[model samples]
Target chain A: MTPQLEIVIIAVIVSAACSVLGVFLILRKMAMMTDAISHTILLGIVVAFFITESLTSPLLIIGAALVGLLTVYLTEALRRTRLMAEDSSIGIVFPFLFSIAIILITKYAGNIHLDVDSVLLGELVFVPFDRLIVLGRDIGAKSLYVMGTILFIDLLYVILFYKELKLVTFDAALAAVLGFSPIAIHYSLMGLVSITAVGAFEAVGSILVIAFMIGPPVSAYMITDKLRNMLILSTLIGIINSIIGYRLSVIFDVAIAGSIATVIGITFLIVFITAPKRGMLTIINSRRRRKIEYAMASLLLHLCNHENTDREEIESNRHSIYQHLNWSKKFLEKILYKALNLNYITLNNEYLKLTPKGREYAIRCYDDIGYSI
Target chain B: MQKHVIEVEDMTVAYEEKPVLWDIDINIPKGVLMAIVGPNGAGKSTLIKAMLNLVKPISGKVLFNGLSYECQRRYIGYVPQRGSVDWDFPTSVLDVVLMGTYGKIGWIKRPGKKEKEKSLDAIKKVGMEEFVDRQISQLSGGQQQRVFLARALVQDADIYFMDEPFQGVDAKTERAIINILKELRLRGKTVIVVHHDLQTVKEYFDWVALLNTKLIQYGKVDEVFTDENLRITYGSTDRVLKGEV
Candidate 1:
């Protein structure tokens, strides 16, 4: 396969896996914890390299995964101390470990192939170069295989533990009472997150990994309200982001990983503004409709209170009622039009009178306001 | 001569050496709708958490039908506080109720037709069958409370622990929940609730256990639901709390 194709393939696989797990992380409000763990895994990588003296050693993955779990464990432990808030606990734990790793790399391992910049902002250009050879036959790009394996593992984990994950995320105390140890499920998820971090670190880098992990799933969360649909939508968004990002990088001659992360961000922004039910526009529209309804109800109530007005000629007059209500002429016109459109009111010459339907609605509004008619 | 379904022996709980509950010994007989009543921070919820082993008791033992909670977990169900979890989670009412069957299916086994039927029946009993497919976040506060009750009901456990099921529910929802609890009790199941309201203690509960960092009283409603005991449990309250208003 072409190097460009290989790079895009690796990016897609990594994005897909991260987005799947990102749904749970977002739902559980642990998305930041994933960021913290991915950062802290650098310390694990440094320690594992010092011990094994080999880049391909499986101990590196184990070490990084362990540190990921440790980051989460320490954050939780700090939170349990009742000393600091959850974010502060994470802020304290990951940076300390990450700083140590960076210090160790700059001071000691200056001669290594591990580029700190590439680690933070991954280099997908190099992904196509790392070819895997098996049984004297040429295989595909090594990063692709690694990311693919992690995606498969992630898919399996999500499917196998869907029920437990949902139950625990939605209600941990009840899950605990029902004999499902939420703590156990949490640690296992952290461990998997750590492994995924290791798999994607070389291709997407630490910072970009978070972009993939959080952005698409959060976007998908706004787009859908079913967990399974959210999962599927997030995966689709990840793939779409990967393809568009790859094509953009080709045109701009820029970093592939950074492009993917940027595309994911843009996608999230689009979803945040345009999601059918949860978008900003939808909320604003609903609020405006409710405001109009509330205003019409108030207008009807005013007319109802003056139903037996002493002055029959001026009682329901719009000018008198609007002035009495302290409402702007535009506001009066807007709600008046809306009520007339709904057949709740009619203009008898210059006076506003409530229809039979309007009186019933007015009575309901009185009860809603905790007042007896 | 009544048979106790739950026995709590020397159950004491402390949060980092700040004693929350002290020397609490109580026996909850089967088929009784019991209310654990207390003022704020009086450890009413703590007692239920301790019994379910969600909280590590400083020193205590809770037995369900002469067995450890872990050994007999299949026979116990719990409905945590409505605020315990975010209702915005991407799940339907049916999915939440289906979780109650997970204990029976154990790990790796999915909820099949039988489990779905049980969950549906639980939803029907809660009068939330119409909302079975609705997303949880779209539900009203009372509907969410009913959904939680249905989740626990699907467990079909011999004993249930509920923490403030009526905390924010409407009057109709509260009545619906009470009816379900009554039904469970009639079917020989034990229902223990952490209740804050004292006015309805006698009307809604047959058994009352007043807790305030200790077991103030545990007996029938007529025996324990008294003005003097309430005053003691709440630690000298305002007129409303003193049950004088």
Candidate 2:
């Protein structure tokens, strides 16, 4: 396979893995913690590299995951103190670890191939060339195997502890009484998230890793209310963004990761505007439609109360009735025309009369108003 | 003559160095509706947390059914305070209640048909059958409380620990939940509630445990719901109850 194809395939897999776990993290309000893990893992990577003198060592993943778990443990410990809140704990720890990683990188490995830029932004373009050769056969990219393993772990952790994680996220104390240790589940989840970050770091870099982790899931959450559906949708969104991003990069001759992030952002905007039922435009239109319907119903009710009214009297009184409705004249006309087309109301030049359907609709509105009051 | 389901000995809970609840010993009998009442910050909720082993006591042991907490965990159900959870969490009423069956189903096992039946039954028991598919945030405060109660109910535990189940609920929901607690007592399950309302304590609870940084009283309402105990639990002045100052 070509090096570019290898990079695209690895990016797709890593992006999907991060997005799947990202859905839960965003839902649980742990998105920032994932960000924290991604940064702190740099320090762990630097330390592992210093000891092992090899960037390709699996020990880096283990070291990074351990640091991630430690970050969670330390954050919890700090929260126990009345002095510091949760966000502050995260603020204090990640910066310290991250600064240490930068210092170590500049001092020790700056002259070598390992540098800050490679660690922070990652090099997806070069990933395809870093192939794992096994038994004299060129097995795909090494990052693919690493990300794939972490993805499998993430999927297994979520599936195996699905009930426990759901219960604890919803109600931890209740989970405790029901013989499930929510703390245990919480730590395990953070551990898995950390491991995912570590695995995806080499391929996607740190910043793009966070975007991949949170963006697709958040976009999916905006469209669905079900957890299972959210998971599937987020994975699809992630994969779509990855493929689209790679294609966009190829077409525009730009950065692959940047293109991917832009695609995810665009998808979020699209979902925000076009989501069924809860989309911004849908809600606004529904409200406007309701108001117009209300005004038309009120007019029909007024005409029904004053049967056989003169055309002049009804026309002059239209403004008075519209005043009570607080609607624009154009809006009132639109609804009136719609009512006439549906045979809900009959307009004889200026006089308005409610048809059977219009009368029934007005009666339903009256019932609703009565019930609300 | 009822058997003691929970026995806490020399329980001391502290945050950092300062003590929150100190030197507490209490034996609660089974099959009674007991209310843990005290002023704010008196550790009423902490006591339940300690019993469930959610919080580690500075120095003590809490025994359930003559066994350690781990051994007797399956027999206990818990309903935390309303504010303890994020209301906007993406879960339907039925989904939240099905959590009660997680312990029985164990790790790695999903809630199957049996669990669903139990959850639906619990939702019906809580008068929330119509809202089984509604997201928890869409429900009223009282309805959310009912969902949590239903979640605990599906646990089918011998003992239920509820932290402020009536807090922020309407009068109708409060009465409905109390009725359910009474029903649980009838079925031979011990129900413990961390209640705040002193006015309803006498009427709602069959047994009472009053705490004011210490165990002031614990027994049947007729025996322990005295003015002297109230003064200790609510703190000495008694001006609030007397309607003076």
Off by over 4 Å in 1: A311-315, A368-373, B237-245
**Chain B: TM-scores of all predictions:** 0.96, 0.96
Report how far residue A245 has shifted in candidate 1, in Å: 0.4
**Model 2 lDDT per residue over A27-145, tens place:** 77888898899989888888998889998888988888888998888887887776898899999988988898889989888877767776667778988778889999988888888
**Model 2 C-alpha lDDT per residue in residues B1-245, reported as the tens digit of each score:** 76789999999999878788999999888798999988778899899998888898989999998899999888888888889888877678888888888888887788899899999999998899999999777898899999989988888999999999998887778989999999999999999999988788888989999897788889999999898888877766565566431
Give Cα-based local distance difference scores for all models: 0.89, 0.84
Candidate 2 residues lying further than 4 Å off, grouped into runs, are A282-373, B236-245
In model 2, state the lDDT of residue B100: 83
* Worst 10 contiguous positions by lDDT, candidate 2 chain A: A311-320
lDDT tens digits, residue span A1-373, model 1? 8987888788889989998998989998998998998889988988999999988778988999999998998999999999999999999998898999999889878899776897899888888888888998879898888889889999999999998998889889988988889999999988999999989988889887898889999999999999999999999999999999999999999888878889999999989989999998899999998888788888898888888778645668877777887889989988888889989899998899889999999989988874221
lDDT of 2 at A210: 90
